[model samples]
Target: MSTVHIKPVPVTPEEVIAVARDHARVVIDAEAREAMAASRAIVDAIEREGRPVYGVSTGFGALANTFVEPERRAELQHALIRSHAAGVGDPMPEEVVRAMMLLRVRSLAMGRSGVRPEIAEGLAALLNADITPWVPRHGSLGASGDLAPLAHCAMVLLGEGWVREADGSRVDAGPVLERAGLRPITLSSKEGLALINGTDGMLGMLILAVADLRHLLTMADVCAALSNEAMLGSDRPFQPELHEIRPQPGQAKSAANIHKLLQDSEVMDSHRNDLAHAVQDAYSMRCAPQVAGAARDVLAYAETVADQELRSVVDNPVVLPDGRVESTGNFHGAPLGYAADFLGIAATDVGSISERRVDRLLDITRNRGLPAFLSPDPGVNSGLMIAQYTAAGIVAENRRLSAPASVDSVPTSGMQEDHVSMGWAAACKLRTIIDNLGTLLAVEMLAATQGLQLRLPLIPSPAARAATAAVGPIAGKPGPDQFLAPVIEQVKRLIESPALRHEIEEAAGPLA
Candidate 1:
């Protein structure tokens, strides 16, 4: 496995995706270590001077007015970790936890969090050793920095929580740390607050969601093209000249992609000059680029937000190089919340449009000359009729999930922390929407391919042919339906597979 080196500078969303989803190893750079040391020196001076600092010498949130003696400061740090590790529900996925850890490390590496280099090194060791902490899925208000979830992560570093082994078994972190030749170090002044106070959790999930949505958006264009060809729809709407008039970058790109996919299509050529065909097709076939392209543009905006977030330092009472420690609101997750909610809305619309295309492929009247439901005997086999229902159900769920989580806020910490951002909620629901969209697109792919197969002697474009061939290995040619649930799942797998998209792109050239 390749390793991703973390420096003091900001990382790109693509780098986050590589480390989070690809399980890449992590190493902190020398510049980051130097920055961390410089920051820690400021914190040490504050502690020595016995001045009251929010997280260094004083208490936190509602308890900020309380003072702590130097002798018991370490105990304060330990208690903070124990009390805040109060998250509930099922543990988060391992990938999410790992991403959270990496982002936390990156934030501390900025040298603004007043954390020691050893602390950052310990996190890197945990990633390198594959010892994942069990972080719960709930209890984050996305203010004061995903406190509960990150505290659970810090618990593992303190040798007090569970760690997941490579085989997926949970064990005491103490023993695992010992086995890895690692020892849990005591937290110094502000170290505990620094560990738990950041937007890493929401940010990590947002980055991963952006990567998935990007791929799915491109695949949507391919599915739309396949549906256009299978339904004998004209490629005239996708011509560059037609799209240039409107000039939406994403819309133009989508039209270009569809045009390429339908290039050299015998099925389209066969009906090119037929005046008997309707002058225009239905909205589902004719306006696919406009709908899907709008979603693509929304995703582009979300990606921009993720990129800016990656470079930010998100912690409270951040240590400064000029030797001043000041409190700030960088930890608030509203930015991430808005981005996740926007993507959710986009995913819902994209899935909804894809479902409509699937419906068109099944209706005999609308599917042009294709058989009813694309089944040899429509009444007996039922064909893909229920698959559309499944897609519809998922699209409906996505719509509900698309409600903006940022708008809903509840006060926390004795009202000391009020107006919290539900960014974490937005991020979690966006993951579900992305998964649902993938399955919905998969159903469209199956129906579109079946429609193309029924066209018989008249072949689809090279791109559509490649798409159908990719599915052929996983889902056989159209006929009387067998156990369709498995076929839908198999085709879903193919739709999500990079190989399928690679094949289509190879035949049709690069898609936008």
Candidate 2:
């Protein structure tokens, strides 16, 4: 198995993606172990002194004032895990659970959580052994550090929950741990709290979402360029000189990408001297850079936030080297919530614009001289007309999903936690929006490629030709309209395929 070294420092989203999606083995750094041991000494000392140190000795949230005796401290930790592992609904994808576990291990390795090094190592062992705990999709409020969801993950370490086996069946984790030469960890002072009290769940989703959006956004540019070429749109608006006056970095990059994709096109050349063509194109074609570029900029800001969160130790009652355990609100999910909400809005707009381009391709009156719906035989076959409807339905749903969940706060835990970030909700909805965007872009690719092929003798640019060829194998050529649902799925896979993107880039260089 390939391995990833986890240290007491921030890791990039790419690293998180590798572990979460690619099943990389994890090994904690020696320095991180030393740091964890040092912090554990402080927690042990506090336990010996019999001083109530929040999570170390006392009950949590509304019960913080209730102190437990040292003899029952271990029970407190176990009870905390059992109670907080109250997540409901279907289990989250194994990849998402692995990400949450990895992030929790990374935060604990920072040594500020006062967890024993064994606790961190146990989490790493689970990842290395490919033992994914059954974490439910709903539970976290995005405040109090994704407590419920993380607790479900922590339950597996204590040999108390279900784990996914190699064959994808859920089985008892205790047997799995024993078979892997791992023993269930015994919780010590603050160890259970350390395991569960962090922003690992939301942060994990945010990091993964960022990685997905990065690829999809770049692919969006490629799809837009193809649509623009098929629609016979002018490239004059994408000139570098025209973009420099406005000077949005993402905008300039997006326009440059479109300009490069349209370079040396026979289709474009065919219309270069045609004065009868409209001087400009519709907003969807002409403003592709402006809209997609704005999304690129939003993603950059979100990446910055994810980077900062990666470095943070977001636990309550964080241990310090000077022996002070201070309770702070560092675990609040507001920052991540705002970023997720903004990204959803951006994704919705990107999908919305792509739907517009798909719409233009289907309308006989609006599609220049192309046949109705890009069908080889109009009226007799619906062609891509319903595909446009599907895309529009998803686009409409995205607009509803893009409503910011962060703005609303609900009180919980006897109102001790009066305000919650709801960042988890935002992150979940953003994921849906990103998926819907891919489908929407796929519809545009299907229609645009068909429209370009219908243009015939006048071939598209090298980049467009490459993109069309990449998707052709999956979507096939436009003919008597067969069942399109399967074809749309195939095209969506192509849109998300890195190999297809690479093929296009080989012809047009890198996109924005």
Candidate 3:
């Protein structure tokens, strides 16, 4: 699909990923153009009127008291970038760097940061040419605008650093700019502060994380249904009318997805006979909707925060339309930081519940008709027993990692940057949790599929049947203790593929 054109309204996290992955071009809107013009006019007035603004005539951060002469202003901006480009860690993935460039362009397009037009243009050219800067993973408090990492970005604009070219070659920005016929930007007034001070880096990571999580959530519903069918658990918990009374959008949506994924199967309808072994199944099966639904709720709120961050001109000393410069704390990462941590907590639960289901599948007493290790030769061969151990270990790790990152802070920048959001920590940690959830889900699929195969002749719940149809041909049933790793790997790919992901999303839509 072609990328949607955005005006002044904030861009959603999903929109940011779609644009970057699909190579969308961003254009400045009329209002944004006027905002840019007003900012530029104020800057021109500063240069002409000889007004002493914080960053325009003075130094940055702890060096605010030192003043730069008018002749040295351009040199000062260049020096600011060179000195602050001290980010040290592994280089960020290429896609993330591209998303950062896209986000930086969108933020500048809002036109309130007093940056020159070429600054935004340079970013756009990089996006078009697929030039990704080698931004590092660490060294940001997620306040003061993700200083170290963003400085690396700004350094590329001056063509004084290095960037990854279209074909993955790292080239010096100076010669590349000369070859591309582009000029190095000279910072004017608040431009350096504008370029470096904002939540773009954290926001970019969150956007990609959220987009991938949305897909993973869809995969979770399908996997949960498969596990549900393998156990022949009652489907009474997912009645649409029951959820309709309270009507949280996410809860209602999850219940509906469960219903649709099981709609055509004979297995769900066949078990209407109330043979009371226990009145109902456990909470892991019964409360899947509630747990999964709550995550969706947090995701909705996080999307709002992500969108606002994308469009906001978050630099300090913002140029107001009335031609006044106001230094403020809009660059703080608290909102995005907390949201990322909340998302990690929410996503972590999906893995937690799925682990319980994996345990249930392996327990012969709990699993009813399935074999002790889910093996045909129960006593001799230990089949899928160890799979649960792997899932358990992953779930425990996720629990430890889900601790809130926003609650912690340390002083920096001579204590001026005291109470940072730690949003980068939140973003990176959440990315790990999401990946772990994927592997956990993959493990469950291997075990559940094995259990269903053992419970042959007796049909599975309707949702399980559909999931088997979706994944069975791709990964056939294992035999005689063969390497189950390939089966788990295959199921993970099926769960993650665009086709199966779309099917689950369609199932989720009716509840909305």
Candidate 4:
């Protein structure tokens, strides 16, 4: 058999998402090796000189000043894992655990965490073999870099606890590795510290969120196009020149996207002539470009933070090139935490406005002569009425979740761990909010498409028409109570697909 040597691979945030969603293997490269060596040298010097490093040579957390004997350092490391693996509640879903593994591997590949090369190799190997440690969902303050959750991850390397195998079986980490023909790495000086001391958990969730956010933003544009067509609203709000005068990047881009999606429609110019109905539509329909545009702006800022974080080494006691080891708060999750909280609020608003559009479509008075709830049978069918309620419920929940987690702080590790960022909470809530938004938008897509069809035989804007066609088969407007969960999942698949998004955009005409 030919040998295929696996080398260390460079990772980007997008690659992390891909690996999380689709079980992809990971490898390390030559460049990563060099960086690892540099970090190891600094850590080794500190160890040999008997200098007290926060996590490497002393007790962790509030007990940082408590020193340990040299011989017991390994035991100390193991103890840290056992004690910090205090996560409670339901275990995280497989995809999230996979995301954590991918993020941790990429962080080590950056080669600044002072972990042994073999440690990184073993972690990557587990991922390659699809051995994901079963970590709990709830128990991180998001300060000091997701310490509790990551400790569970590190414990699996010690062959001490249970993990999920490729086939989704929960088994002991030791036997799982044995069956997979992979050996666990030994805990050494700063190795355990390196593994558990970072913002990988929060960052992993953020990577997934940002990717989904991009999709939702695109879906927002598509939904707006459909609403515009259904309402037969004037397209003047999307004029490029109108946004140019205001000069907001997101506004300009969003308006351009709307203009492009509606460009080829014969119905648009026909409706532009002083409408007998009123001057312009409500803010939800006419100001779709502006409101959705703001979300794009916050998402851009969140992306920058995530990209830089992927390349960063966010552990305590960083090692420098000149063989100097310094204890610092690099593992602090404030930056990512605050950004995630902001993104939660912004994305929550997206769903909030989407529900409003759903309300308009369902209301008999405001729906421009469409049947109540878009039902052909009206009171007999109650078509899409409860779906609007579901949408409203999710949006209300999002509002509650939108309250910033970053603003709250609780002291842990005694007073030493004072001023926590609650970053993990922010990331977790953001993930929930985004998922809810996806379902809400999916429902909106179904509702708006039905409204468009009722006004049928009247051609819609090219972009809206194409999106409707793409989602038609996935989430068709069925009669009452047709098991919407499956249909919601189908629409989610469409939302996640970049190819479908591009196709819809292409049909809309060139992006303005």
Candidate 5:
């Protein structure tokens, strides 16, 4: 297995995906261990002096002023983990749990968390062993660093929580660690607070969402171009000159991508100079780049936030190089929350526009000469009429989800941590938005390809041809529909996978 090393330098989105999604092994860097030891020495001094620091010698949150006896500090850390592992829902997917664990490990490895180097090494062992703790889905307020989710993860370190087996069944962590030739590490001093005190869950989802959206964004352009060709819409709107005056980076890129996809097409060329066919296309067909491009810009902005966050010291009472332990608002998660919410809003626009194109494809009045619903027998065979409905349904759901989660903050932790970021909720709903949009686009691909096949004599653009072939036999021939749900699922799999986008990019040079 390939190993991802945790260094003090800022990590990349790819690294997080590797450990989280790809199940790659993780190793803490040697320099990070040295730095952690130095930081631990400082924490040790504070403990020795009984200085009543926020997390080291004192109780947490509402109990911060209450002093913990020296011998009881370890018990304090243990109790903290047990109390905070209060997440309540079905377990989060293994990939998300893995990402959260990796992010927490990365934060601690930065040497500012005042944790023993062995603590980090222990977390690395769990990751390397794929001993993912079962983290419940709900209960994060996206402030104080995803406390509940990370605590469930931290519980596994003390052999207290459940870890998932190969088949996703839960088992005791103690036995799992023993089987992995490992022993659970006992938390000491500020270690427990350090483990759970960061925005790992929200940040992890944000990074994963960014990665997923990149693929879906490419698929959106491909489907839009397919819709344009299927509907016999003019490609003039996607010309570089039209986008240059406005010149939003994402808009220009989407325009260029659509241009490439619509280039060298028999369908486009047949009517390239025929003004008699139509004057202008609908907004869904003409403004494809504008919508998808805007989403791309939102995605880019989110990436900037995720990048900076990867390099951030998100733990509370972050230990500085000069041995100062200070309480800061670094763990608030507002920045990440807002970024995630913005992306959700942008993604809904992309899906909405795609939904409109799907509607145009099925409408006899709008779909040029294609039969109603693209059915061979318009009345007897409903054909892809219902696919548009599916797309519309998903679009409506996405609209509701696109409402910003960052602004809906509720007070948490007895109101001491008021105005919570709700970033976790933002991140969670964004996942669904990205997914539903993909399904919606899959429906578009289904109808667009069926529409393309109906325009049989005039071949689609080379890029559309490649993507259509990738969609398989269900989209290849236009006839009475058989099991529309499975067909949509089949194309949804194609959309979820890289095959469609890969084939399109391979045929067309590359999407932005």
Candidate 6:
């Protein structure tokens, strides 16, 4: 409930995520405003000298050498924003737009963008009011720091573009600013360019994706263990001694979680000495910890990149401590793009492995004694057969989504930016991959929980019972086919919630 203060230093990814997703209010710290004032003083001194500056006294991109009269500089900045407000496709989710605005303000607050402190203050106020700008989905090339999308955000600050109202309607921003007792920002010489020239958009998406994957990865372990138990397979692969030698931290953590979840299972004890069970389980069941743990490590690396980016000053011609304004390539988004793409591939693989588990749960030949498609009645009901189909289709889509978006780029701005990062594309596609992964995992959870249900009097491990109990309200018991989409959605929401983790941890202790 506390306001997220904008400090003079770099912000944390947690703070950015809070502001974006939680609607946490923000206010600029006085020290950051003072820093901006000092930085602005340096820019003011330069403007009076009449020497050409890349963004202050001259035009942008390929027109860097073109000069405008002192009287036309304000017009130049506004014109720049208008021309760059060229994004196409649907509006980005409100959370992404909010995060982008917050990051821009954070960069300006760092005293590097030569922006007036008021610019940051006005943005903070808009964010506090939840007045989200309409940033179209496609625009950023990732090299120029998501210019077009950020430009749309900057246009909203100037009351020139549309903003999403409290009722979720897109309306003119001028009246919204006024009704909220806020005034439109009047761009000074460099303020407009200052607002748009940063890697906020792609970085914002990367941060959100990391947050989502952390939870989903943990859930991946939960579902994997449930499948192993439901299929009547051995949990020996999750034994700590088996994984300690390899010592991949994520793998160890996942193995420990599975080891804990499989404890107290009467089913495993039911067939322990019976040679009827397969000597070894399929890779999906036995190698669950390996693949999911690798994904956990991938997310850790991506989180490191996200944290570094959060603290970086990602703008061109940054105002330095020594009163120099020098053009730099710090705005390039290659780092964020690479992180997004890597996480995408990892998430896709995690989903693929989970889909295989779902297939095993449904296949009569493979499910040991469970019914075909996990149906309560074989021929009378189709059961979750279609759910496995959904998982397979989603897994296929995720594989395509995992292709590296950062590996490709197109020149823009008349070749002034000859090599683009395409990181925004990478981050955006990563969002989709994570979402798809979430849904596919939901199917695994659904089918696996139903498989646990069919086990009946054969008691499940404490962790499996707890995890299934968390979704029991909607998932119910194994029965004739019901509408599966709503149940998948319900379980998806539950998987993303704290309740599942709380219950599972209560029984299995904290998951890694």
Candidate 5, TM-score vs. the true structure? 0.98
Cα lDDT tens digits, model 3, 317-410, are 7887788877889888998999999999999999999899888887889876677767778667778777778888989999999999889998
Q: Summarize candidate 6's per-residue lDDT along 388-453 as a digit string, tens digits.
A: 889999999989988898989888778899998999999999999999988998999988888998
Q: Judge candidate 2 against the unseen true structure and give its global Cα lDDT, from 0 to 1.
A: 0.88
Clashing pairs in 2: none
Measured with C-alpha atoms, the lDDT of residue 100 in candidate 6 is 91
* lDDT score of residue 356 within candidate 2: 96
Over 1-512, each residue of candidate 2 has an lDDT whose tens digit, in order, gives 36778888876677788899999889999999999999989999998888889998899999989888888889999999999999888778887888999999899989898988999999998898888998878888988889888998899999988887657677888888888898888898788888888888888888888888888988888888888888888888999999999989888888899899999899888887898989988999999999999999999999999999999999988999999999999999999999999999998999999999999988988888888889889889988989999998999899999989999899999999999999988988988899899899899999989889988889799988987887788777888988889888998988887988889889988776
lDDT of 3: 0.76
Give the clashing residue pairs of candidate 1, or none: none
Native RMSD of candidate 6 (Å):
1.1
Candidate 2 lands at a TM-score of 0.98
Residue 246 of model 1 has an lDDT of 97
Residue 384 accuracy (lDDT) in model 5: 85
Off by over 4 Å in 2: 166-168
RMSD of each: 1.2, 1.2, 2.6, 2.9, 1.2, 1.1
Give the higher-lDDT candidate: 2 or 3: 2
- Those runs of model 1 whose alpha carbons end farther than 4 Å from true positions after fitting are none
Model 5 lDDT tens row, 318-419 = 999898999988999899999999999999899999999989899998899999988989788888888888888899999999888899988876778878
Give residue 212's error in model 2 in angstroms.
Answer: 1.0
Candidate with best lDDT: 6
Residue pairs with colliding backbones in model 5 are 145-198
What's the TM-score of every candidate structure? Answer: 0.98, 0.98, 0.92, 0.93, 0.98, 0.98
Residue-level lDDT tens digits of model 1 in 304-397: 8888888899999999899999999999999999999998998899999999999989998888888888897878888889999999899889
Rank order (by lDDT, best first)? 6, 1, 5, 2, 4, 3
Clashes of each: 0, 0, 1, 5, 1, 0
Error of 5 at 440 (Å): 0.8
